[model samples]
Target: SSLIGYGRGDVRNTVGNIPMEWYQDYPHIGYDLDGKKIFKPIRNKDELDEFLDKMENPDYWRTVHDKTTASDIRLSDEQVDLVHRLQKGQFGDASFNEYEIHSCSSGPIVEKKKILIPFSVSKMVHAIKMGWIKPRKPKETTPQYYDLWAKEDPNAILGRHKMHVPAPKMRLPGHEESYNPPPEYLLTEEERLAWEQQDPEDRKLPFLPQKHSCLRAVPAFSRFIHERFERCLDLYLCPRQRKMRVNVNPEDLIPKLPKPKDLQPFPTTMSLVYRGHTSLVRSISASPTGQWLVSGSDDCTVRFWEVNTGRCLKTLEVGGAVKGVAWNPNPAVCLVAVCFESTVLLLNPALGDRLVVGATDQLITSYEPPEEDKEQAVTWALSEGPEHDKGHRLTLTHPKGVKQVVWHGKGDYLSSVMPDNTSNLQVLIHQVSKRRTQNPFRKNKGLVQCVSFHPLRPYFFVATQRCVRVYNLIKQELTKKLTANCKWISSMAIHPGGDNLICGSYDCRLAWFDLDLSTKPYKMLRHHKKALRGVAYHKHYPLFASGADDGSVIVCHGMVYNDLLQNPLIVPVKVLRGHQITHDLGVLDVTFHPTQPWVFSSGADATIRLFT
Candidate 1:
């Protein structure tokens, strides 16, 4: 191993640049050139020997420890001289000179020659390469090209607008900006201090008013350069646009609509009022022939009324508050379904035709189930003795309260909604002829608000809190889900055409959905001030009505066109107000007459009103 010094090969340690303390306890400090351990030098100097060596040795001052070899290295004369030169801030190599002159004339030089070509020759070569100078026409037809350089009228171009607007002129200098001004326009000492403290943009005047002896005596404007810079910034940063003003008649903006007077056959005024119930009337229904109307009330009574006159034909005490009442839509049958608590009473009503009433009673009691069939969702029992005397032929007992009952178009089948959350028993379809019940849904989506049967198809609609589901009874599968986009749906009604439907919500919104268009609501109408309790569509007229808690019924003409491309036109025609708000409740249910353009509404005022 050799020492690392100036002008000496540094090939001592074979272990690379590592700390010497790692080998303190080992016998060998490092490896040598042949990969063999270099043993540490033996000194074994005592304190007296070290003192004697320091006193006698003349080169002790230049001695340094070499940890790699565990020995002491002495500086040579040449190394000492180099160290002295480095300490004096001079170059270590004595032969090297820092400042030296260089000359380019001593090397051989070559000159470059410039060559130029004619511009026409290069252009001809480029044209030949691009085939612009063809010898003959090609066999294939060439693409058509537009002659951009052809002469044409500049005004005939499409993008060239004829209108040209000039920049707005700056405002003239006000009296306050004059070098000399009236005394009233001058600022007080307090006002001057306030102006200086305020923001530049907030100041009322851009310049301070002053009085000068004469025009010649006025000093040069002090803020001329700053004002010019601000003006330049406004021009560059702020965008200015000039819009054309259009003159249009205000009346032309309104849509042209037929006058209400022209839409005559619709109900315009109250024609009758049947008062019999002592409590709030919850539901109302008109018979198929529009001759009789039945209503159910919270007073535990159901009243049958004559549509032509304001007379309560009969009132039967059911022992429980009635929740819903629906008349058979088929003119061939004379029956009414009244739901109260957990029981639904199929009453003949016995008001229309005698033969029809008798046939309805017999039709309801003709069903007899087999002895082995014991899994019905509802228990069917005959209404005997006193109940039969009151026209109640059959009674349907369910496990939960039946909120509503809707009959099929054929009048042989009916469905009920119980809204029971404990079990998946919210909806049940009943076939009166067979006296059998079927629970269509095994798992309820949410609280079932209402249920309805399609007017023409074998479909059922069940409305939950936020959406409405359409089920095809024939297929026994969900056909489509209509997004009502409401907080809480209260009721639903299908149009006679069966292509559209409307849902009323407790959030005072009415959403219309087109089955063939989209599942999402086609239009959302908010014309009621309070929650909507009931909504009904006319059987033959292009009209629909809504009863709200605000004690008002709004009738709108909803004309549905046969063309698929045209949207339905909705127009509010009348607002019938007669039922008074009682205990935060108003009109509870509404139904349209089957044959006439009239409507019947049962309200919390314990009365039924007919508008004709």
Candidate 2:
């Protein structure tokens, strides 16, 4: 770029001649002594007026001319006098001392000489600059800013002045520095759980879900892994729903299945209703013989009823409320696993119809109400009394209480998850032959979501917030970890073939992961309206179902084919919506009939619906 020359023009001559408002935005403009652009702030209207008054005098002009000429020869009075003496031929020492000089090549020996001047100039320059001499007044003339005659003339440059709004001053905005509180300081009850969940140490990763020790060794890294996965899948890690929608493709659609006539009549009618529990039923299991349906309820009892009739054949008083119910897969064993507050009780329902024997710990000693403002409360706490051995019972104790109990393929071993254990040993493995309980981890990995035994091998998989880890029970070490491509897993089901796995999340999301494909889910579907609670794959049919807190169940024909030319298909056959929510609760658990195209759904409404 080249510079533009303004010649002799400067702010001293041009700015004052322009309109006054121009100074508000023009900043400062002037010219240096060498006629280059320079800025000289006039400061205010008062300073500008004073500068204009002085510049307009002819005496000031004369002083400027004299100062400019004398600047080169500027000297003191004594120096000027010495110069005059030198002009009359005065000198100090003319004789050169050649012997004193070491050598001519060493360096030059310098001497001072006085320069001549035509006249003494110091007094004249200083007097003019200091205002010792008054400026001579020239022919009086009006100031350009107030000259109405020149402004009225159209030929003049400023005479045709245009009225335009002056531009505002230039500025940039900046934020004030302040302190921000830590996230924990701002958390409510719900937010507190989620904030603490950022640290793996604060989260329980039961059943070797994420290798809690290694991940806990670096809490930041563990949270990053979990958070990044949830972020990528667009699922809310918190308990509440986030409004952001996930990205989807056309392939994400759940293909509609053509209704088969045999299954058509089955879903259209509710064949049987098993209603015996006084309170809400949380767990249910169908018998392998298809003759019995066992259910555990919050009323602190387990009941066995015939599948054909809606009658409760037998009821057993287990001290603690039953949290989970699992039927043994082996026909030879034919045992039913029941989870209590702190014990896993395995019972063979066919042995006898007798009540479990245990000394009751008084739940409430007295119910004394106020004499005037009578307030009554009932204690439903578990009875912790002396242990009594029942011949058909296998009791395994978990100190922190159990949330879920899962059975292995042959029913020889079972795994249980403790929701109360935040630090160590939340996953309990009970061996029937050993008659004892065992834990896998010393520290938690994350909040345990679900656990299941591998269909074919000795491995069992545990699902946490954002990871799926499978451990080989024989070796007692983690064999594989699925760096999941999904969000918080609420419930999971493995295909009977042991090839495909499906996990449903609290954010109303469903992911189907193929073991042979990759650690990431092969398909992701979000068709439910609430958090998922249960998922099951039919043992005999090419179907899978998911139940949620929205009081509905989705039955899909998810048949897997190994042919390279054929793609495994998933078709949503039906959406069963009969379960009514109670106390903000919906379907608690779901299971399929082994041989029929029938699905059983249970909810907090205290009614079991059998679709056959």
Candidate 3:
């Protein structure tokens, strides 16, 4: 074996343990610690010089060859003596004697002396004999044994039966399992063989049913014991869950509401019936003072009636069927606007104060159009020649038939709806005082179901088939669109507060929308059995009513709160029934008295009924 050394001028070779013969042909022996080549020393001596140096050197016998450094190392006298001693089977260290006795001068050696103990055993025995050292006494106990398979006492166990589930009850055997079952229940031979060959879980029945000819011929069930064992296994191995049933009263599920008796002052019964028209009364309106009422019918007649006496004071025969009628909501004006065919007639009812009626007529007929005025969608003209004598002071002519007309709150502006699809002339706003007509919409959104004016603001509501669009007339832009959440809308009415609106649909649903709440309806009501034809809101009371084709009017108490965090309260209170259904048409129109809780409904029976 060769050794490597690290010294001042030379570093140990980095080449790991291997034979030096592999580097015999190279000039360099191996690489050093720095990975530099370690060159072989130059040897110029021949055999004669080597023999002469060996004979001349005095320490030749003590010289040793180092293979790592490829050099000779001379040994010192002490090193030579150590080598001789080691060769003679003695200790490698010169001062260490092999035959010396070991001893400690300070005290006897005490560690790792297993053969000798420091204390005397005889002294401990003497102490025990003298009672100087004592032993602990054993504790006394009585041993008891119990049966391993004994049943535990239920009361003695802590919370042993909490959340325990009772085992499921077994299903009772049907008639097919009877000993003398019907012939249809008896299995054929092939079915019996198939049942025998199928897996137990796949079999529909635990045992085959047989139709015994007589009761005595029936034998005992063969799988009864096996079935009992399987049932026991299922009860022991299957997992069970505890189900907590909540007992609740059915009445508790209903929402709390005030009784109808407490929510009184709503129209409950028929008060008067104005009967004159020979056909269905399509529209009706009451004066702002609630003293007079007017109705238009399909019989081509418009009648004015005293609201209290139900007496028809005047009847003007129109040339066409009257579709809608609206009285000016302004208490200062006494004018009624009636729609039929393609024209709307502005009529002075002449029933109230004569001065107010005269003022209304003069206000309507005073406007004169400029000669340079351009043509419009609606043509405004005065009642000409003989037509002037019949109370028709002004006539609004449109390009198509108009379906409905509603007046603005101020009595100066009114809007008419014409569901014409051939042109963009569906809704036209007319200023009665100026005798001017202007189209509010550039294009039709859908078939115009109805149109209404906001009671307090400049907002106009145009209801289409599925939505009601509120447009600000002053801004000339869309303000908000309300989703009806029902099929085709039939009529709409705004609350006098101008913050809430109600729309009646042909699907027999009434949707109430809070303009400040959301674009969707706040509540949808479905009380009418037939499609709703008209809806009206009382101006002074927190009451609203809807007339449907079922010939019944339903009045509901609708109270709106001023708090934005709270929703409106609606409670159905009364259902007034008197009008007879005719030709599939029941209530054609409904309107409320401006200042009272009274609601008037015009039906297809050609009679206008008032509920107070």
Candidate 4:
């Protein structure tokens, strides 16, 4: 693990301790050890001088320096010279015979060597005590620091720099009173005459015309003349005026007056009867009698509950994401339509049996009889024509996934909003009937996130990316479009009376507007922390429920008065929370039972919850 090493050794002279040459024999210094060379030692000053002279030469110094330097070692001048000279110039025969340099250089020499020391606490302490290091003191307080300290003290006397406050009444050239007219002299006699002579129509009065007589003289004069003439004429014509004779008796002349109608006061508050699952709820539907409640949720199930008991009567598993659940208007059968991601199932809740009405693989089929008897016979007889095989064939109807399917209250039609797989931003409306008519309500250009038919009106509201379009079913045109200034409409719900519409947006705001006015939201319910997914209006109460990505369902009350001109009186009546509700696991849909006060919410967690 050690990368570098340092040690101490013996040499009589120290020019800088660095390796020179290998030594041999006992007491050897510069000579290689474990060899034949013995310690002859430098006998006198002359021998020492000769050795030093050999080591000092620059040419000799370079050779030793090259070896130590190339190996990343430090070398002394004397040692460098000796090694360099030994490696320089070819050895002559006389010089080789005259002396053996290694033997002469070897000697018993004792030299103190310094070794590198490791840093430790003791070393640091020693360094500090030896005055090799200085301790630093903390810095003085900064201005901000002093200010904070002063704030803590409360009673500390502080010194503030002198500041010059300018005089309050500094006179500017135009503001000086010397050139301005005094109060009394503002109007000169000649100026007053000129003003008085000006035409009343051309005059610009300081106060309103009625406040002063300067401009009111003509009107007042006209009124006075009219009153005088009216008085004189009344007196003059009183005697000569013709009088009509009564043609009938006073009793007959008096006709009967209709009686005044009594005013009926609206109810101030309505009762909210919460009845559904004990867990998170997704979608809810009420029976035709407005007695029983049905709700579906991410719990992968639908639950039937008694509206008055708040009791969960039956829970049935649909085995998929339960988006919407609705009760058939028929009170006896209590058919519940549950919509899954790829399929919609019509469930007989009474029998606990479910039938898949439509699926991704099942295509919508239209049956038609042949135009003529011969054509019908040919179609019946042909085995392989385009129109031959028409019975009991599965067709893929919805290419894009079905998000929601709502049936008209009267069961005259069933409408489904399906996302276009080619573009989720667009939605296709499919209506089912014996005679399937093209949706008189044209398809939306932007993504239709949600669609709901008005409870009473012949219009259904469709929420798009930037606007809410109300389509008139009877007129077959978009009756009104509510634009939300670049805000994406995430969900929409119509008031029970079908007079108002509530919309949730990606901007984390809930808005309601009158069906007739859409320029601005009348009531803005701002409570959701994220984009709202679904909104449901209570059938009996003034309350509405909205579900957001925050894993919470918020109930806003009193949204009926919301018009573009009035702020809706909305208050959060309840909040339901359970899952983490991440970006992907946002609550997707919500619905309220028409008869009961139950709410249901479907979330991305693949679980649905029923809340009362």
Q: Estimate the Cα RMSD of every predicted model relative to the unseen true structure.
A: 35.2, 28.1, 30.3, 41.0
Compared with the true structure, what per-residue lDDT tens digits does model 1 show for residues 418-472? 9966779999998887888898888998999999999899889999999999999
Model 1 lDDT at residue 556 = 89
lDDT of 3 by residue, 1-612 (tens): 345233477556767777777677678878877889878788677999889889999888998865554566687787789889989999989899776657655354534343354356667878889999888899898885444333455652222433343558997677788989888788899999999999999998887887778889887877899999879877986796546599999999988999999988988878898999999999999888889899999999999999989999999998799999999888888888999999898887678798898887777666678875537677777886677767778877888899999988888889999997677889999887777788778898888979998888889999999999999989999999999989799999999899999999999999999999999999999999999999999888999999999999999999998898989999999989999999998998898888778899999999999888
Worst 10 residues of 3 by lDDT: 156-165
Residue runs of model 2 more than 4 Å from their true location after superposition? 1-268, 351-392, 483-487
Off by over 4 Å in 4: 1-320, 329-333, 351-397, 421-443, 559-568, 572-588, 596-612
Best by TM-score: 3
What order do candidates take by TM-score, descending?
3, 1, 2, 4
Candidate 2 lDDT over residue span 1-612, tens digit each: 111222355222332233433333344443345565444343344777758857785344222211111111234445455556667776423354534624445333322111222134666777889999778889888864533344445666445664233458774421211123333334366754665566766553211222223433534444788778878666655666658688888776946556654344335457888887887888999877677788999998888887777788878878778889998776555578888887777765653222211211111123322354221111112223332223234556556678898888876787888764355666767656534445676666887867999989887898888888888878988877776566667788889988888888888888888787778777887878888888899887888888888999888878788774565687676788888888878888889887788888888898788877
TM-score of candidate 3 to 2 decimals: 0.62
Q: Against the hidden reference, what TM-scores do the models get? A: 0.61, 0.51, 0.62, 0.43
Superior by TM-score: candidate 3 or candidate 4: 3
Candidate 4 CA-lDDT value: 0.55
Q: Model 4 reaches what TM-score against the true structure?
A: 0.43
Instruction: Quote the lDDT for 143 in model 1.
Output: 70
Looking at model 2, which ten-residue stretch has the lowest summed lDDT?
356-365
